[model samples]
Target: MRRPHGVLRTADVEHGHDLLPPTPPTTVGVIEAVATGSPRRVVDQRANAARVADLFADPAQRQRIPRIYQKTRIDTRHLAIDPLEPEFLEFSRKPATIRERMNLFFEHAVPLAVDVARRAVENLADPAEEIGQLIFVTSTGFIAPGVDVAVVKQLALSPTVNRMIVNFMGCAAAMNGIRTAVDYVRAHPDKKSMVLCIEVSSVNAVFDDDVNDVITHSLFGDGCGAVVIGANQVHQPLAAGSVVIRDSFSHLFDDAEDGIVLGVKDTAITCELATSLPDYIYQGVDPVVSQVLARNGLDKAAVDLWAIHPGGPRIIEESARSLGIPPEAAAPSWDVLAEHGNMLSVSLIFVLERMIRDTRSAAPISTGVAFSFAPGVTLEGIVFDVIRS
Candidate 1:
């Protein structure tokens, strides 16, 4: 029998390889690696948007929601809770209590966090036991011991591993998580760190006729993103190849707090999103790019790829306009939003993860600039250098 073309034996799998393509030889540099976890549920935007619009109880708002959902550029998303589930959907008939919402948060977020955390660790080809610290980021819910403890237990990291939580930080929480981990690794170069972001935006669903609730339902989704950064004294691979954290920067638009908001009321997370978000985001991100680039003695032209947060389609356009870059530069952000509606803190990291892979095998891998926004009108940015062999 003729052997299959280039068939290889599947035995000694002990070699140092990861999910990502290995870096070419003659160059060993640090890299930042990431992975994503599957959401518990999937939702179709066009259909769910219509259903959520009906919950408005007002025909005017119902008619308006479709246009808004269509304009969002999101066709689908993964949700932690089913929108059509009787328990969650009966909000108009009987509003969901805080306890019920919190229940969904715990039930869904715990396992989701564990899965994403594991994927992150597995991607590194580094042992999980060596992770010096665990950082958890979430804006959708709160707990006493919080999601960090559960994540460590499931991931089986050091029981004594340092734990930190970046909660209620909104979409930018993942950046803060990475920033915290980077700070730790900088101090303890021998140690590695993991940052996990899990958002269950569906659990925060509001069942009332409020315009904000309808808008929130139409916009947000659920999922988790995890990353492992090399902080050792020597440059370590954050992923399979040579991707290093060149720099990261964040800024807050003064008096712009009113633009986006997340709050808790009677158990479920409450949202206060402004319609003028695109204008605000465009205005906010331009300076952030300049500030981050200038500090590194670089400019917009030096960036080969962009991990822009797709807070929305309009926001993506605004981000591109703000940076004065071509519309294609922000294409990846829009792609993420289209494939999966904004997953809050989990959203931007997804964009970055793909950029990391794209850099590995495609153009625009080097000098990647990542950007995401959170409440407090905060703009978080990070720069990555994919040093290929």
Candidate 2:
């Protein structure tokens, strides 16, 4: 395949080694900095449940709502809309059409994306114009010229910066985006790149008595996360405790495409969660993690930390059990879940940011693995090490 116009080929740079195979790039990608942005409104589970309870007229369902919300173990979430507001309550009862939902998405998603991207860039040692690639990931919204373009224009990123948009991949999109960044930096070690994940689940809210809808509503919150990555060759002396992406792994559970369904309907965006998803995650995480570790000549015990996506309380617990790690090892995932709920593709990045900060004072070298699940019952894993400066 032809390289893009400005991306240099090794052959072009090494004048005397024409007959030899190209050497590997001498730099690894480092996660320079990470930043997160949330909607201004903080929605407490009790008030959220109370507002949701009004939507279900049945006394029995109303009684079940609070119990279901409590079971999620999410105390508060950052929602783009206030659940207790009369206007939002009215909209929940009479759901908006798909067009209206998309409008809500456009109005809120771009500004959040730009804000998070700005923060991530601010943490970088390089200027904003030095960012050569921009990847925007979201499962909750779509637009032509999309959030990527808005981010570029708003952040004053290079006009010629490479751009990618990953849409509708659900929770796993963030890992995939990071992997894409790793690939980019490995190929173009001189360039810096960024991955921005923003999900406005509140805009796609589904108000229904269905248990799946109730669980989905209880678990997701609106938020955006951004990570700035660049080859170590370009950004030497990145912030202390910056993580280097060592390797990545991905797997799709056989015949499990229907495990989590996210689609759009005339009434609103729709989400259907399978009851067996926790079981799927429990059975699959071990193999994906084992293979990645084994390939890297390490094992589970060698890892100092884990950034398991907090898809839900059960998902986190079962994943820890499968990995044979103590519950506290997955505490970052649990804490993020309780504070922010699931922000879809953005949740794992939030966990990553927290782990990097909390472990800043640890030993000189710390190994960590991150995992995220999406609609395919897919698992995306990354092996990384934090090196203190």
Candidate 3:
């Protein structure tokens, strides 16, 4: 069966009243710079691929699991906490509770987010000044004031700086955060806005025998990605080769919400990576891409870069095939996934940082498209016009 490319089937939209709603384009802001940081602890799956499989001790259950972790294409990932640390080794006697896990999130997320944010703003003329707004995005853990407060306090940002948190929005949350930052910059053109996507997927790991839990465990690592967006004409101009927000769009999968699940359990968060996830990405990519491009008055040929989220290998593969994006266009995303696993809410921003920082991308890269999927069975797309320095 051949899947339709570059067009949304009418059938999918009929079931949902709000499949795609185009938002009026926001004022353009330059993506001054991009940066991403990890927790300094690295794990090479290649070395431990077999040993980690031992996490699943039931032989009958183990036989059904693929030792390759589905050939995740992931080579190495960094974690805030080494899963095999002596303390965690006695898991049966004392598995980590949600409270203990959140404690780790607060400890690790702040410095990681602050470092990436400082790196982004360091590109400015004065360096790290003039940032008046902070938008923090993460899905793995929760704190009352949110990590945004921590980012500001550590950076010594102006106490009056506006703060907003995009919580539990999953992988694509960064793109949504970027959109909101664009709105903030547009509304307050004199100010600079910083967006941080910090995901501590390492701490979210559950020590369980469930096959789904095992699969999810193999695909997560801890990391933070940040970008600074400012008015093009501001005192500290965006660095050259910065991506400008051309437009943004949001869409849903009609009835595919069940395909990706992240739910809160009594003592921990549980996730179910349903088999149809690839299908959900496949079905949603065309419409989301088509509509976003169309609304921006862009054609398929305009995009020289594709910043699609690397949710998984299959998600990336099916997306490129469906959207007619060249294999090379998705390589950064593949590399990020292979190197970082999926950092939950922080994953897509890492993809964007790769696109922005690639020296090969050079300058005057006119147009680009970024796509990411979330548990809404939601898809958000952002179109960018890269201005060379």
Candidate 4:
């Protein structure tokens, strides 16, 4: 059965109060690395923006309007070296080399993922033995034992460390992973859980030379982000600064599953994104946001921080406009998109990490709303408070 919102709320009272054992503070630590194999061949947004426009202007794809292809302020996109190199045209032109392609892709992807996970975990002073759980999230590549195993092998974490893999959920899966960690930390307030969100989207590219493929190719880049959540009671100086996970809420739009989907066909994965996506978010997101805030006894005006997924430029604009979020409130999201094309599941976490890192003063009883939309037409939402240590 689907759980109703606000069925429970813990961690509300002051730290030393008798209502509950002091809730262990949960904080986010981020580490991000650009994939080495994916070279930035085309490093300008305007040029790519024009390429994006031309791709959708084809007569056969006239129905796929260019307007829906939001003008990404993406100055550059990373591409795998062999794929982008002129000499690789022979390999690119071929079809039906699935096993060979998969092998090549994983070889490059795994190392970058390991590097990203290692760097991120190293940011936390807690020894590997103390990390009781490792949650790995990704949609672009698949491998047995996966990132969880890779992290365990590299970090020398306990063999008993609880491991979970959240896969194929698209951009919103990152929140799902975080929500899972939140529940774990809430249940075991003495344990620490690490979340590693890595997306090597460039590897999943389909070279169909079609409009849908072009848009997908142009909009995504390679990136990975890792975060750590721990119980607040242990209280190891609170990391000097951290964003506390006060509460989180998720809402899924059941009727709109066809609005966005990512699926595999033959040797390539296709991203089927409807042009009406902006309309869907604009029409649906407000009520969900309202319901989520109301359940927390918050009004629209009470939310001071919004770490929304930068799905694209139009999605971001429409979401902000639909939800009545101010321009300043959406600035960080826009900045992320301009600097790095959407990294799918990992993008929202990156935004949240930035907010936590950049806070210089005590943030208002700040309510951060991080959300993203994807297949199943999911609207994954997470709300948290930024507490000053």
86-142 in candidate 2: lDDT tens per residue? Answer: 776567657446777777888899888888888899855654567889888998886
User: In every candidate, how many clashes are there?
Assistant: 7, 0, 0, 4
TM-score against truth, every candidate = 0.86, 0.89, 0.87, 0.80
Candidate 2 regions with alpha-carbon error over 4 angstroms: 1-25, 92-96, 123-128, 209-211, 233-239, 359-361
- Model 4 regions lying over 4 Å from their true place: 1-42, 47-70, 80-82, 87-89, 123-126, 233-240, 360-365
Give the Cα lDDT of each candidate: 0.75, 0.83, 0.77, 0.67
Least lDDT summed over 10 consecutive residues: which range in candidate 2?
16-25
Model 3 residue pairs with clashes: none
lDDT of 3 by residue, 115-233 (tens): 88878787566433588788888888887776788777777788888888887778888888888998888888888988888888777666555666667777888898888887654
Residue lDDT tens for model 1, 1-389: 88573343443234523344544333221335677976856788899877767666768887898998898889889887686677656752354477777767888889878877776777544455578888888888887676888887777777889888888888788878877777777767677878888888787776555666666777888889888765533443343444677776888887888888878777478777786777788777888788788977899898888888777777778888899988788777888898888888888878876765663455424787887888888888678776554
What are the clashing pairs of model 2? none
Candidate number achieving the greatest TM-score relative to the actual structure: 2
Q: List CA RMSD, all candidates.
A: 12.6, 4.9, 8.7, 6.9
Kindly list the per-residue Cα lDDT of model 4 for residues 1-389, writing each as its tens digit.
Answer: 87564333344334433454444345432112111122344345555445445534356554343433445666655544424444443565467645555555566666666776666566556547667788888787777756668768877778888999998889898888878887787677667777887776655565545656667766887677777776564333444345565566666675777778887655655577787787888888889988888876887888878887886887788888889876567777877777777778877876876776666657534567888986877788776666545
* Top of the candidates by lDDT: 2
Which one wins by TM-score: 1 or 4?
1
On lDDT, the stronger of 2 and 4 is 2
